[model samples]
Each structure stands twice: as C-alpha cells, then as structure tokens.
Target: MDRMMMSDLLKTIFSVLLVLVVIIVSRNFIKILKMAVDGLISTEAILSILGLKIVLASAAFIVPAVFVSVLMVLGRMYRDQEMSALSSAGAGVGRLYIAVFKTIIPVVFAAAWMALYVSPWAASKVERIIFEEKQNIGVRAIAEGKFSEYNKGNLIFYVEKITTDNVMHDVFVQDKRENKVGIVTAEKAEVRTINNDLYIVFINGERVQGNAGEVDFVLETFAEYAMRLDSSTEIQENPITGIDTTKLLQTQDLKELSELHHRLSVPFSIIVLAIMAVPLAQVSPRSGVYGNLAAAFLIYFSFANFEKVSGSWMVNGEIPVWLGFWGVYFLAVLFIVILLVRLYGLAWVILQLKGKLV
Candidate 1:
C-alpha cells in the first residue's frame, strides 16, 4: 500500500514538473526570440541557440518547482480527505516521509549533476557560439553606399561601390582623434587581412591630418597605404562556467567559494525542502486540498531568497564566507525541525514551557 501511494505521488510530481517546464521554456524562448530579432540575428540561428539555452534554464528552474508542486498535490490530497482515509486504514505519517525520501534521493542526484556539470558545460558552449557569431557576422554587415561608423566614431568609412570580393571603390575614411580631424580619399581600396589584423589597403589616395589651432599637414599617397581597423577584443578572463567543481573545491577565493557553496547547496536544499514539505502538507478535514499551496510557495520562495542573499554576502566579503554560506542552510534546517516537532505535537515540551505556561 505504501509503495503504491509513493508511486502515485511520484507520477503526479513528474507530470506537474513537465507541464511547468514547458510553460517556462516557451515563455522565455519567445522573449529571447524577440531580443534576437531586435539585434538582427538570423531567425534560424537564434531559434537553434535559444532552444538550447531554454532547455538549460528550464532544468535549473524546474527542480524547485517540482518539489513545490509535489507538496501542493499531496497537501490537496490530504485536504480532500484521501490521506485521512489512508490514515484511517493504518497508513501513518512515516509512510509519507519514506515516500518523500525515496523521491528526493534521485532528485537531489539529478540536481547535483545540473549544478556541477550540465549547467556550466551548456553555458560555456553557448558563450563561445555567441562570441564567434558576433565576430564573423559583424564583419560581413558592412555594406556599400551606407555611411558605416566603426569603433564608436573613432573612424567613419564610406564606399561608393563594393564588389563580391569585398573590394571598395571611391573610398573615404575619416579619423577623429582628440581635437584633430583627418580625412583620406582613395580611388580604390580593398579589405585585407595580414597577421590577424584587418586593414583597408588604399590605392591612389591623398591624406590630410591636422586640427584646429594646430599646423595642418597634407600628403599624397602613392601605390598603397594600409589603414588599420580595430577589431573587437576577445575576452581572455576565465568565466565562472569555465571553472570546474573540483577546481573550485581547491580554491579559497571568496567568489569561487560562494559559487561552490551554491552548487553544494542546491542538492542539499532538495532534501531540506522535501522534509519541510511533508508536515506542511498536513490538512484539516474542513480545508480543501489546495489550501496550503500559497503558504508553501511563500515558504519555498523565502528560503530561496535567503540562500541567494547569503551567497551574495559571502561573495562580497560582507560576511565570513564559510559562515554566510552554511549559516543559511543551518537556519533552514532548524526551522524545518521546529515545524516537524510542532506537527508531531512535541513543540510544547521542546520549548520547555509545558508546566510554566498555558
């Protein structure tokens, strides 16, 4: 009988999680698609990339939601007197706890995989794809007859004609440096790459470089002049996703410590949350099955926020890293124990006020 109940509860939780994941993923994907369109990303490319991101994000978001939903479902069942019927037939609260424990072990293992392995791998791959696309696509976007500004007005380039080979005819280049304004005109120019640097090779051109309140200089260029184009700087700093869990464990850096704390906490949180949920799901005869859902949501969200706040404080050095990281979990565990004692009618004795107070 206990095994059957546990199976039913697991099925309910799985169904709820699936529905929630679909909803969240679809909503976020739509938002990302809009942003990609606004940024002029190709539709097919954006969809492909956004799909992967949505799956990763959905996995992270759904874990806690699954726990909450399961609690709500069980709470509703109790409120509707199904649990009461089982209790009358000799099923005890112990059975519920056992069921929850069975479910949580696998859930926590999956959560550990997501936080430690899957999420970072997905994030790193997505970041690399985005970087490559920006570099390659941006270079191809320079069109002829359009006044193109490169590097935030440091240089303005215009061409009257562009060919299939990216050669430009009647090219004009304007360089703005300090109070000086320099302009160069070339009869023909070609985009060239040398030593990983992008340059515009000009043929038959005259150069003028000067500024107001300064002596002006003018020179005629002969066969060729190479003007260097500034390219986007590739990021070299190690992103958080690039750091593995094992590597993080060996470091004492506050930021890395905080991230490691979060990774470890995610799985532990699943267990804590499961323990808290069982007692919270208890319902009186008069109340409906869904009566405690709002409260459960409130509690879950508060716990999540507390963890976030503690992690942030740890990273910022506003609190001792070890204390801030573990302190929140300890507090949560204490709260759960108190709630469980209350549910078991042992709170009065535990408070040591049974004889002293009414």
Candidate 2:
C-alpha cells in the first residue's frame, strides 16, 4: 500500500509541476520578448536569459506543486475507497503519514538545493547577461528612421539615416534632466570611445537647453560636439535574488535577511505543507478526488501570500526579522493540529497518541 501510494504521489507531483512550469514560462516568455523589442535586452541573449528564468520559475513553483499534488493523490485514494481498504487492513492515519513523508523527504532535499543555490546562481547569470548587453547598446542597438530610448526613457535618439560605416545622418537627441530639457540636432554623428567612455560625436550641431515652458532658453551652434552615452566604470548593483546563499548569511541588513529567510522558507514550507496536506486531503467518497481542492487552494494561496506579506514587513522594519518569516510556519503547524483534531475528534486523536505511547 505504501509503495502504491508513493508511486501515485510521484506521478502526480511531476504532472502538476510540468503543467505549472509551462503556464509560468509562457507568461514570462512574452515579457522577455517585450524586453528584447524595447532594446532593454539583446535578441541573441533572449534564449539564454529565458532558460535561466525557467530555472528560477521552476524553483519557485516546486513547493506549491508538491503540496497540491499531495492533496490530489490522497483525495483520490479516499474517493476510490482505497483509503477505506487500508484502514480496514490496520493502516491508521499514522501509517498514511509515514508513507506520505517517505515521498516528501527526498523532495525536501532537492528543493533545498534549488532554493539555496541553483535559483540564485541562475538569477545572477540573468542579471549579468543583461548588464553586459546594455553596456554596448547605445552604439549597437540604434537603427535608422526609428526613435530609441535609453537611460530609462530619459534620453531619446532618432536618426534619419545610417551609412555602411555606421555614421548617422540628421540625428536628433532629446535629454530630460530633472526640470531641464536639452535638445540637440546634428547634421551627422558617429560613435567614439574616449578613455573607455562611450560618446556620440556630433558634427555641425545645434543645441538648446532650458526648463520646459520657460523663456530663458540657451541656444548655441557648434562645429563639433560630443555627448557621453555610457562609461566602462558604470556598475549594476546585484538585486536580492542574485545574492549567493553564503553571502546572505554574512549580512545583517533587514532586506537581505528577509531574502535569506525567504530562500530558507522554501524548503521548510515543503515539509510543513506536506504534513498539512495529509489531513486537508480528507473528503467524502461521494465528493470526488478534486472535491476538497478549492479549500486546499485557498489555504495554499493564503500560506504563500502570508509569507510574502511577512517578508515585506521584515524588509520595511515593521516586523522583527527573526519572527517575520518563521511565525507563519508556526501558525500553519497550529492550523494543521486544529484540522487533525477537527477531523478525528479530540478524544480519538488523544487516544491514538496514547495507544502509540503505550
């Protein structure tokens, strides 16, 4: 019976994980494609970045998939009266838990590795690839007869034509800096690197600078002028997701601590949710295998959202970092106990425990 249960659980977990991965990957693919279209990322880097994104997405969904899979497999057994047969053959709830946990143990270990190491590695790779692509974007990404935006839309460049040698003609540049707007028009322009700094060298250009709608505008015409576009010294700070697990252990920053705790919570949640699923999966034979899924989903989403809100609270200093992440798991354990008692009755549960003790 345990072997059969383990087999069903494994199959269900893989099926659910695959379906979830496909759904998430499709949505993220659209966003990645848009990033390529907007020139935020290179077309050549799309597939590489997308593959890393899949790793991250799969890691994020694995715990939830396992939880849901547990519910479905156990619920099906109950609906099919297999659970009744087991109970008749001296298989108690404790026996069922042993079988469920035998499957969960390996999953928890695999999930721990993914959440701690693999996902962070993939996130860092994606960030590094994007930063490297953006460094050369000013020169390589520009196209004739199209407006391109850079520096997060603060700078716009438009060129009427481009020669085979990569010189631009009839170039228009608009830079919005705080309250001031600067406009430059050039007869011809070409990219030049001076001292490792990227600059657009414009010849026979006119410049106008002033606050918008203000009359005190400065206007000048130049024989040659250069505008800095990017510099080799520019550095992109690593986001929380990209930080290595070992490095996160050395930090005392609330945001970093929150992130660290979140990674740790992934594996912890797999265990807790699996335990909760044992009781939560209980349903009447007539209700069908999926009958309790609505309630299970509600609990699952609430559990996930609670973790998110707690992490935010920790990051914002609203809650102590030590308590914010693990408190929800404690509440989940309490909920599981309450659920077990509700299903089996307090006296029966106590009697079962006492019997085991004796």
Candidate 3:
C-alpha cells in the first residue's frame, strides 16, 4: 500500500517537472533562433534550423531538468510537513530514495541512449540540411535581383536576369585585391561546375583593372572567360556528434575519449542526482514549500561544473581518463550520503530533546 502511494506521488512530480522543462526549453530555443534570424539568416531557413536545434538542445537538457524538478518537488513536500507525516508513519527519509530511484533509473537509461545515439544522428542530419541550403541560397537570391557577396566581401556578383535554361544575362562582377580593383562586364554568363569548383563563364566581356588613381589596363574577352569564386577553408572535424559510437571507441585521441566519457556520464548522472535530491530537499517547516529550490539549483550546477572540469582535465592528460570521469560523480554520491545520514540523525536528536523538555 505504501509502495503504491509513493509511486503515485512520484508520477505527479515527474509530470510537473516534464511540463516545466518543456516550457523553459521551448522559450530558450525561440529566443536563440530569433537572434539567428536577426543576424542575417533567412526567416524560412532559420525556422527550419530552429526546429532541428531545439530538439537536440532539449534532449541534452533532460537530465539536468529532471534533477532540478525532483529537488523542487521534494523540497516542497518537506516544507509542507508531508515528509514529517511520512516519517511518523514508519517511513524514513531514506525511503524516498527508493521511490525516486524507481522513476530515475529508466530516465537515466533513456538519457544515455539519447546522448550516445540519437543526438549524433540528429546533429548529422541538421548539418547536412544547413549545408545544402546555404549552398543554394546565393543562387536563389541572385535570381531575385539581390546582390550576393561571398569570400568575405572580396567578391560581389549580381545577375539581372536568369532563364529556365540555367543561363544568366547582364552579369556584373567586382573583385577586390591588395591595391587592385577589377571590374568585369559580361553580356551573358552561365554557372558551370567542373572538378567540384563553381565557375561563372562570361561570354563577350571586357575587364578593367587598376588602382583608384592609376592608369587602368583593359582587356576584351570574346568566347568564354571563367572566374573561380570558391575558396576552400580549413574544416576541423568534430568528434562529438559527427562520428558514431563504434568510431568513438576506435579513436584513441584524448579529446575524443573525453567526449565519449561525457556522453556516457549524462545518463549515470541522472541516477546520482535523483539520489542526492532526496536529502537535499529537506526544509524547515517555516521555510515555505519552495524554500530550498535556490540552494538545490546551486548544488546541481556545482556538481555539473565539477564533471565538466574533470572532463577537460582528462582531455589534457592532467588526470587518468577513467578515474577523472567517475571521480566527480563519486564525490557527489558521497556528499549526498553524508547529508542524508545527518538529516536523519538530526531529526532523531530533535525528537529526543523535545521528549525530555516536555
């Protein structure tokens, strides 16, 4: 009978926590995307990007949200004397641990799956979509009479007209180089792809090149002149999500290993946090139902920051990977256990004091 009541209470707590997480995460996602749109991304494209980003961000935040939620609920219960009632009815503060674990164990497993598998898959898909969309944006903008700038404003191109045959007419190109300005006027132009390079082929054009106050040199082009506009930038491969779990295991790089540990820790941290929340939630009767929420948030973040620092240290070889990854979590568990014991011991001492005084 007690088990059933505890289960019902936990369900109510979980539901409230889930709702709070969704609202907070959604608001954050919208704010971030609005900033991106204002910064030059097309509204339509930003909407698509926002959708992809919010899902991944929300998934990542689940464990932390759960930790905060549990703390809040338990703190309220304690402040309201519900926990005192339970204790008087032969339930110890430690019993709350069992009830919390029942809900948190499965949540931790789910978080682990998301961090290990689902997050990476989502990241890859988002990248592919963004890449493809960005590649076509300039071409689409040109058709609508928009001036397109690329290569950090070194190149400016405009197309007055485009046909169904993929042919462009009345093209103007400007190239800016050190002490040199080149302007090319073409009667017609067409985009062509060769060896993975995009070239604008100009037909019957004239080029003028010189400094602002120097004699300019002019050249006339007849049949075809191709201008290469694409420059390759160095791309650093990310280990976090672009690679699969199997690949992560194969790579022996410290950074990759650190990331691997970080991913695996997310789910495990949920269980530790749930255990920790049970005792941390205790509050004085006069403190009100929300009394311990601020403290709980601080403690949760402190533990999270410790884990992050440990991961960084592991990557730098300042600590052993396995030990560094688990050390913070172990410390957190120890701290929680001590706190739980103290809370129970304090309660028992207070009862004896009251009995003697009475």
Note each model's CA RMSD in angstroms: 7.4, 7.7, 7.9
The number of clashing residue pairs in each candidate reads: 1, 0, 0
Error of 3 at 317 (Å): 1.2
TM-score of 1: 0.70
Each candidate structure's TM-score, on Cα atoms with residue i matched to residue i, is 0.70, 0.75, 0.68
* Candidate 2: residue pairs that collide: none
Off by over 4 Å in 1: 140-231, 236-238, 347-358
lDDT of each: 0.74, 0.89, 0.73
Name every residue pair that clashes in candidate 1.
Answer: 76-289
Q: For candidate 1, write residues 28-126 as lDDT tens digits.
A: 778767756665454446766676676576556655765675677677677678887888988776677776677667777887898887776777666
Better of 2 and 3 by lDDT: 2
Model 2 per-residue lDDT tens digits across residues 86-182 = 9999998889889999998999999999999999999999888888777877666678999998777777999999998889999999988867899
Ranking by lDDT: 2, 1, 3
